[model samples]
Target chain A: MWQYEKKLQYPVKIANPNPKLAQLIITQYGGPDGELGASLRYLSQRYSMPYAEVKGLLTDIGTEELAHLEMICAMVHQLTRNLSEEEIKGTPFANYFVDHTTGVYPVAASSVPWRAEYIASKGDIITDLHEDLAAEQKARTTYDNLIRMVDDPDVLDPLRFLRQRELNHYQRFGEALRLTSDRLNEKNFYSFNPSFDKHCNK
Target chain B: MAMKERIYAYDFAIVEMNLYLDTHPEDKDALCLFHQYQEKREQLIEAYEAQFGPYISNVNDVQGDKFTWICDPWPWEYSKEV
Candidate 1:
């Protein structure tokens, strides 16, 4: 059994209700490259990962993504906490309020609803590991952008925490890739899997 | 604390699952933990529905007569309620 923590992995408090910023940040919640997709993808893909280290990395990163999901939801909630119908209808939040009424709905800034296409779950370990690496980098870039767009200490506090997590995840995933590569080397007794043929035999 | 617990349970499962899988990828120990976490998650979800009205607004699964016993009373209404 896992123990629960009362505190967020990082503190998240949004003092002002900026629905527009919240709407934009919702992209990190449910966009194609959002934390939701990131969490689900990594967690689901772990079983087939060849190396135990890589599998562990997926689980760790995926779990953190879940926290990120909550942080984003909190942001959205704070942003629209007291939004009136007229206020909501006057801004892009109108689209969200029509459906969720202050509730967080996952989607990119482009308004594309959450889709499974965001994740790449090839059964092949090599392909999947490479994809995981790229995904971390993508998320890091997104956090950097979010940090730049928002300047509130409340918002910046969580954003900074999340950005640090991105870097940590990137470093871990990079190590995982190395571990997987080492496994391939030991199994082949060769320098590398040049053709990618053996591992690609799906 | 209730909302935080819900999130933590899910995250705890993810972290524990990864750690277990790191060494015992198929040890079944990790799988057992996975099941435990999932069950806890269901209980938390029920608790959430009971207290917060509903975690998801459109869904009403609290009526026991209906097959939607998924909702449990929120923490404030726990047996420890004042």
Candidate 2:
């Protein structure tokens, strides 16, 4: 039961319309390490998580990722607004404009549409948490790459904010991993899947 | 717009504290901070909605005719001043 909040997680007011930049930023919308994948990964993995802390973390973080996804779309929409035919004629966005026409679509900079294969929901708690840790790092790297290429302060502000969030999420996920492992067998955390092997301790 | 920014800031703090508390559920200080921000956030939201229509769909502060929920300039819509 999600409620709609008619506001973005962060404000994205791009004074300049840069379709080229939009093409790049849209990658975060549907890229391999995009927010879409991040949200789905955590939300889907929560069902199999064995600990209360892990479950709550996944739900909260997953919801925040959805907010991030909306922010990304707002960026893309603002960047591509009011483009002329001439403006779209020579840029890489021409390919996208032909299909979407100033509309935002979830596709990578390379024009790959979003797919579920970008995420993993392993039923094992340790494996799933590790997967989440790696996912956060990858998303942080993507934001870093975006920041390096962007010069607009308007765009850079939100990118920096989102990049910081990735770091925070990584830290939280690391804590979640530590908390999870602390409850498992001290010698071998992977000896049994706590999510499924209920009687292993006996 | 200033009110909206205040609401955003307070809400942001609440969200950050929420994620922190998720991992550190027993931390009384963090929980206290979370509640404080939440209280301020409610005040900000009430003030913002009074002047700027509904911040969310459930606010239900419509007046006169027309459903204001479908108002122009959705969050995604481009505006020079946003």
Candidate 3:
């Protein structure tokens, strides 16, 4: 069971409200390589994971991704707060404002709504772990792109922290892959699907 | 506010260490560090809750006649003074 903590995993206090920047950052909230997909992918994949360590890592990382999702929402909320009518007239955020009206909605920078197809949860352990590793790298790249375009220290601080987290998750997933392989047949790790082939040697 | 930030730092360290220990379960040094952070985190949370109401909803930190759980300035909301 999950309990609510009335605090963010990290602090997001942005003094300046930049609707333009918020438009870009909202992508992380619902983009293809977003936190929502990352969390759902890992959490869903855990049921099929054969190793206890991988299962625990998936649960922990998935929970952390939820926190990251909250952080992304907070950033978007702060960046769009108290926008004047004139501020919304010609900005890129005007289109979004027409729909959400200062509310944070999950959508890519291109305005595409979030979709489950953005993530994969194949029942295969090796495939899933590789997918997770790639997912982390993709998320890290998105953060890097955001960091490149953002100059505000308030925003940059959290983005950098989040980026670092992606790297950490990637490293852990790699270790998980190694651990999984270590427990498998050294001759041909792919000879059988550990998650499905129940009769295979444990 | 500084106290809250410190608590966040400690909590983050604990979380990072926890993920590490999940895969490297046999690392005694990492487990020790995780426990140390956990202890410090508990102390900081106690102090923080005493001054700033409960950080989680289940805590019994109410004083007079108010339910502080529904207090303003949720995690997402920004305050200039903060």
Best by lDDT: 3
With a 3 Å backbone cut-off (N, CA, C), the pairs that clash in candidate 3 are none
Once model 2 is optimally superposed onto the true structure by TM-score, how far is the C-alpha of residue A167 displaced, in angstroms?
0.5
Off by over 4 Å in 1: A1-6, A186-202, B1-82
What lDDT tens digits, residue by residue, belong to model 3 across residues A103-165? 878899999999999999889888899899999999999999999999999999999999999
Record all residue pairs in model 1 with backbone atoms less than 3 Å apart, i.e. clashing. B46-B72, B50-B72, B51-B74
True-vs-predicted CA distance for residue A80, candidate 1, Å: 1.1
lDDT (C-alpha) at residue A58 in model 1 = 75
The interface root-mean-square deviation of each model, in the order shown, is 9.4, 1.8, 2.0
Q: Give me the displacement of residue A167 in model 3, in angstroms.
A: 0.5
For candidate 1, give the lDDT of residue A28.
89
> What's the C-alpha lDDT at position A145 in model 3?
98
Better of 1 and 2 by DockQ: 2
lDDT of 2 by residue, A2-87 (tens): 88877788888888999999999998899999999999999999999888999999999999999999999999998988878999
Q: Chain B, TM-score, each prediction? A: 0.48, 0.78, 0.78
Off by over 4 Å in 2: A199-202, B49-59
User: Clashing pairs in model 2?
Assistant: none
* Ten-residue region with minimum lDDT total, candidate 1 chain A: A188-197
